[model samples]
Target: MAGPVTAAVLVIGDEILSGRTKDRNIGYIAEYLTAIGVDVREVRVVPDIEEEIVAAVNALRVRYSYVFTTGGIGPTHDDITADSVAKAFGVAIDVDPRARAMLLEYIKPEDLNEARLRMARIPAGAELVPNPVSRAPGFWIGNVIVMAGVPTIMQAMLDQVAPKLQTGVRMLSETVRADAREGDVGGPLGAIAQVNPEVSIGSYPFMADDGRPNTNLVVRGRDPAKVAAAVAQVRAMVEGLRKPG
Candidate 1:
């Protein structure tokens, strides 16, 4: 059987680090990858510095099956993820014919200024991750996948890249609504989690619509049977806690 396929997300933008742009890409990428049997294990937000982007990409690309970076691929001056990624791989970069053609599809030949031409520059031997929303394409070199920062464009690029990625057994999760606080479930849940070594048990505390304290006991695992068993344990515990003393 194939082992778990894992990935890391490298969010590249000065706005993100400065708290100017509320990042919407990480959550979307994580959930999207999870549904497709790819586990996103690490997420790092970095400034728009070329060195930082290169360092983060190198670090994550080696540690995970894939490293996805969103941001810094635009036409503006701060869009340096492409160059930094190329630097990391020690590869030459230039305006690729394919990316340039894609840009021409959206922009008139007469209007393809130098600023817009910057979007077509790709690292040597990188495969373009198509952008359906906008013609500007992202690129994938080895295990590192570069994408746009814009949520809509990034999602479109991911759609093009997903078919090429390796997938593993999809993680299955079951949630048990525990009408109790985390404190009530922590101990028993901890014990249950310790016994079920392969399953992940998490307790999320929230308020109900009626304003009552509620906890959600989520059991996640690759095997449905194991998840079901863990959920059964949680349900039994919740039922036991509700019974009058």
Candidate 2:
């Protein structure tokens, strides 16, 4: 059986680090990859520095099955993800005819200034990830997939890349609402987790209608039977706790 298909997300840009541009990519990508059987194992945010981007790309590309980078692919002086990624891979980068042509669809030939041409500069031996929303395309080289920072554009690029990726077994999950505090179930939950080594048990705390503390026990595992079994145990534990003394 194939092992898990894991990935890391690298969010690059000074704006994000400075808190000027709030990131909306990481959570969306994580959920999207999870639904498609690709486990996002790690996430890192770095400023728009070439060395930072290069180091992060190299580190994550080797540690995980794939590394998806967002931001810094725009047509500006600060946008350096393409060059940084190329430097990490030790590849020569230049204006890609394919990317240029795609941009020409939206930008006129005469209007393709040096700044706009930056969007067309793709690393050698990289496949273009089509952008349906905007003409500027993202690229996929080796295990690194470079995308735009804009949530809508990044989402479109991911959709184009999804069909070609290798997926692993989909995770199954079951949630049990425990009308009790998370602290109340901590000991029992720990014991349950220790017993079901294959399943992941997590307790999320929330308030009921009356504003009393409560918890939602979520059981997740690749195997449906195992997840269901864990859920049953959690339900029984919660029920036992609720019994009148």
Q: Which candidate number would show the highest lDDT if scored against the true structure? A: 2
Instruction: Judge candidate 2 against the unseen true structure and give its global Cα lDDT, from 0 to 1.
Output: 0.95
In the order shown, the candidates' Cα RMSDs to the true structure are 0.9, 1.0
lDDT (CA) per prediction: 0.93, 0.95
lDDT of candidate 1 at residue 67, scale 0 to 100: 95
Estimate, for each residue in 5-33, the C-alpha lDDT of model 2 and write its tens digit: 99999999999989999999999999999
In model 2, state the lDDT of residue 124.
98
Which residue ranges in model 1 land beyond 4 Å of their true spot? none
Would you list the clashing residue pairs of candidate 2? none
In the range 35-146, model 1's lDDT, one tens digit per residue, is: 9999999999999888888888889989999999999999999999999999999999999999999999999999999999999999999999989887999999999999
Candidate 2 Cα errors over 4 Å, as ranges: none
- Model 1 clash tally, residue pairs: 0
